[model samples]
Target chain A: MLEISGLVSGYGRISILHGIDLRVEKGELVALVGVNGAGKTTLMKTIAGLIRPTAGRIAFEGSEIAGEGAERAVAAGIALVPEGRMVFPRMTVWENLMLGGVHPRARPYREATLERIFDLFPRLAERRDQKAATMSGGEQQMLVIGRGLMAQPKLLILDEPSLGLSPLLVQETYGALRKLNADGLTILLAEQNVKLSLAVSNRGYVIENGKIVLTGASSDLARDPATRKAYLGRL
Target chain B: MSAEVLLQATVQGLQMGAIYALIALSMTLIFSVGGLLNFAHGDFMALAMYGALALYQSFALDAYAAAPLLFFGFFLLGFLMFRRLVQPVLAAGVLAGAQLTLGLVFVQENFLLMVFGGDYLSVPTVLSNKNLVIPPLTMPWPLLVGSLLAVVLAAILYVVLMRTDFGRQVRAITQNSDAAALMGIRIDRVQAIAFGIGIGLLGLTGAIIVAQFTLTPAMGLDFTLIALIVMVIGGLGSFAGSMIAGAIIGVSESLGSLLYGGTVGAMIPYAILVLVLLFRPHGLMGEH
Candidate 1:
């Protein structure tokens, strides 16, 4: 469970995410969709504690985590699969997953969690010894997600899960997300693919210009006139 | 010259090569882990030399006996220097860190000068005057000991870097700091430890140097230049390159001395560096 209110963050001296608010309930997959540069990735990074928020109240299970660094956020059961699928390029797929579960609390259960990740991404198990950098884009994406799962995160935030993938891979990725959520994992899914994200998510939010423009049930938001006009490209 | 004289020269060159490799390895490790050129590397070796000397004077411990303590103390100093000074300037680029370290070198050398004066100090070794003569080579026991220690230290470092969890994190950060940080590694902490290890190797080099050579504050700059030459010829961040370069430079300098005049022999390594750079600009083993 995560709650964020009035979060603002950006690079040095330039604000990317203006005042924004969003939430994800326990064991729910919440979709945050928008166009490019819509502050979706910025919001995920802010929640993951990779960027220092200028003003925010980010609470994960009643503890404030807005300004805590990335390592601490991970230790407190938050794992972020960043945009661009930034897996450790030179490391083996297995080593990347092992590194993902390096926090003190996660270390004990690492072996079991690794087995789970391998099961979820069967292709990764076959190529565990190979370098992540050498893998194809779709396989690399799966490994990135599997690496995130190795952390045993209470909240796994997926950023642009379908970017740069083929339609088949996108369907496979979203199907994997559906199965993950069905297994009672909380996810904050950020996507540019509006139809696919809303189809799988129970609740959804539209972000634009670093601010949340609308928030509602996925079914309602998908059919809403303004949401349809701006995101779905329907007249 | 007799066959024995030539053998002695060969043994001496090998001994010196081993020490040079150790010092060059320190530079290589720092560059790879911190992405900085560490111009103050030889100065840190000089600092360890002085630190060892001070400890020896007060406690009368032999150089070998004083190594563990010296390495630990230098590691702490290195960690503090990286955290307090190097890391801040690191963001500006490698040049900034190098300049800061270069300035630190002058400050350190001057501080040693103020305390110990400009006179050369030698550690009185049990093997100082002893030699073991084979059929062709008259080998000094101290050179043997120093070279053996260098090999042992290199082996230990290889093991630590290749077979540990910390090593994985270190290697990851060396390749890409941002990706490692996202995977829950504390980059600052790992980098601090790396800086400590780099200086700790230098401390070992200083201890070995005390066994064979005299020490003085002004010697740091000369040694720093030699280490830089080795790093550049071998490749900026390649350990294997540094070791091979060190040995090549060492043997060539000796052979040069034998064939040509003393000054020309000394210049041979620098000349070889130009040749190597012409062929491989990044370094013989460096990644572009």
Candidate 2:
């Protein structure tokens, strides 16, 4: 339900993404994996419309969404759980979730959506009144995902959701994303955790520098000689 | 201090602090939501004074009628100013936006001077020279009304911020604009409304000021300074912080006047601001 072609974007005076092509079909959990500074975050941001692309097209369900403002992008059914888990630190855990579904389209089903989110993260329900800043990193990571879900998105894009989590917490996060995918949610996750990402994704792509270097079924890519050597750390 | 004297001073302090609290709250709202420090905030208060004067001369409306007019008027002006003056400079960075707003203060001051002239003018509201006497203490109508309104308005604002969906969107924008946008909040729309409310509050404070103080084109600077100091003492973006800090400044200033002299009292809030910055750099109640 999403496509990007010839997507060129960058910070001022320096281009990071050079003609990168990517796609995600309905109900699929796609992983974009690469090492540090591989422009993974930049690509995710470009798709989410936080950063405007200098050139190329990003289409969601056939309509070009390139250059759309972040708000319009969300309205068009794209929600991004940005890197660093940007929760409203001063606001309550529940308040953070409330903000997620503050949009007009999401408002109608906010109660049901909220109940579902609470069911997914019971820990959040317990800490509903507590300030988000006080929550642990793992909890905040979950909060960001739950907040993204609050937007009632068609395509949820997360940038390095497991970046700083402990190994166990990372596993839990990946497991939750797996369940959400099985519930028929489409997801685009960017990560430097190559092995874990490949393990969870239906399809995977390896990015180097700013371009997609490889793509295939998760199992096929995980076994490929180049992918294994470069990403999986198994020569 | 004698009980009666102390009570009198406390009342006066609270009265003065209420005005500062309104201005500081206005400043904080914009800072939190748009991430913009509007230097012209007090100038907008000055504009509201002029607006009130013009409205009164035109329609002879009382405080009730004037409040809404001042609010809607300044909100519209703020909306336009954000779109035209603030937005372009915002692209350059926060400092650029600040500088542009800073420059606007002098522009407004000069405009007011050109129209109203430099003479200090006392606003004659319907409540002029009125007071409530309780033995040795008499509460001037303006101070009593201004403070009462400040408290009531603040309570209303707190309710809106904590309870309403629009308020939630606003707070979301304040807490994290980018994330709010990702949740489908139009940052531009949110920022515009926020800037409007911030400046609108400042303008309404001007309405309150006319009930209490004489006006001149240069009066904006003093209000701006007080608001800045109060916002700092209250912590940058904390509403309760502003109120408590405002009370501290106001009471200190009043008590100083009683103990030392008028000049000394005038200097007290500044001294307290420095001390607070030194000891409690985050502000009396600021979060970060």
Candidate 3:
């Protein structure tokens, strides 16, 4: 479970996120949909502890986490699959995944988590010894998501998981997210693909210029006139 | 020149090159992880040398025996330096970190001067005056033993880098610090340890070379320049490239000195560096 209120953060004197509030319950897949530069990443990063909030409160499972560094957030069981598929280019896929489980909490479950990840993405198992840089873009995306799962985090946050991915690959990725959610994983996904993101999410928030403009059940939001027109391109 | 002469020069060059390669490896580790082009790397080596000398003088400990102690000590010193100095400037950029290290060069050099008084000092081990003779080729006992030790140490480093969890985290950070952080790695802690190891390696070099070369406070710049040249020639972050480039430089210098003269020999490594820069700027094993 996670909660945030009045979150404001930015890069050195240039504020991107204004006062904002958001929440996600356990075992729910929540989607934050916004256009490019709508502070989707800024919010995700703030929650994951990559960027310290200028002003706000972030509580994860009843504990304050705001302004804590990334490592602390990770130890508290928040794993973020960052925007760009940032895999260690020179390392093998196995090495990349192993690094995911480096946290003290995750180390014990490393073997089991690794096996589950391989089951989810068998392509990775096939290329376990291959360098990450040599993989295709879709495979790299899968690798990053698998890497995030390797942490065995209580809350998994993904920023722009669909960026630069093909439509079919995006569908595959979302399908995997659907299964993971059904299996009781708590996920927070930020994406620009409104239709696809809303399709799989239990509840969704529409972010505009760093503020949450709409929040509701996925079905209702998808059918709303404003949401359909602005995001789905059909009214 | 006779074949025997050529064989002797090549063998001698390789022995010395092995030590240079070890020095270059230490430099590469720091640059790859911390993104700091430490100008004080060689000064740290000078410090290690003095440390070895002091241990020898005080306790009658052999240079070889003092190596592990020096490594552990320098590792702590480097760790503290990173925490107090390097980490603060790191956010500013690589140049800021480099400038900090440049300032460190002055501090270390002056400190050594004040203590050691700028004398070219050497330690005489039992092996220092001995030679290994076999048929047409004769090797100095110190050079043979030092090279073998250097190779063994390098192999140990390679194994650690490839097999350890810390090594995995290090490689990950080297490739992408942001992603490494997302994995819950303490970047500051890892970098600090890495910096310590980088400087700590100078302790190994100091011990190995104490008998082979003389020590002076001002000697750091020459080694700094050599390490820089080796890094460039080997490709900035390539471990294997450093070893090979070090060998090339060493062989060229040795052969040049034998064939042409001391001055011409000293210029050979620079000439090779220029050619490598012109032909393959990324280095032999470096990839973009």
Candidate models: Cα lDDT each: 0.84, 0.87, 0.89
For every prediction, compared with the true complex, DockQ reads: 0.58, 0.79, 0.90
Extract clashing residue pairs from model 1.
Answer: none
Stretches of candidate 2 exceeding 4 Å from the true structure: B1-3
Q: In model 3, which regions exceed 4 Å deviation?
A: none
The DockQ-derived docking category for candidate 1 is medium
Residue-by-residue lDDT tens digits, candidate 1, A1-235: 7999988899888899888888899988999999999988888887887888999789999999988988878888898999999888877998888888776668898899988888888999999999988999999999989888878899999999899999999998888999999999999999999998999999999999998999999999999988999989931
User: Candidate 1 vs candidate 3: which has greater lDDT?
Assistant: 3
TM-score-better candidate, 1 vs 3: 3
User: Any runs in candidate 1 off by more than 4 Å, and if so which?
Assistant: B1-11, B91-93
Ranking the candidates on TM-score from highest down gives 3, 2, 1
Q: Write the per-residue lDDT of candidate 2 for residues A1-235, one digit (tens) a residue.
A: 9999999998986889988999999999999998888899999988988889999999999998998878778888999999999998888988899888888888888889999989888889999999999999999999999999999999999899998999999988898899899999999999888888888999998999999999999889888989888978841
Candidate 2 chain B superposition, TM-score: 0.95
lDDT of 1 at A94: 88
- Return whichever of 1 and 3 wins on DockQ: 3
Please say which candidate is ahead in TM-score: 2 or 3.
Answer: 3
Which is the better candidate, 1 or 2, if ranked by DockQ?
A: 2
Alpha-carbon error at A114 in model 2, in Å?
Answer: 1.0
lDDT of 3 by residue, B132-170 (tens): 999799998889998888888887888778889998888
State residue B267's C-alpha deviation in candidate 1, in Å: 1.5
Question: Which numbered prediction scores highest in TM-score against the true structure?
Answer: 3
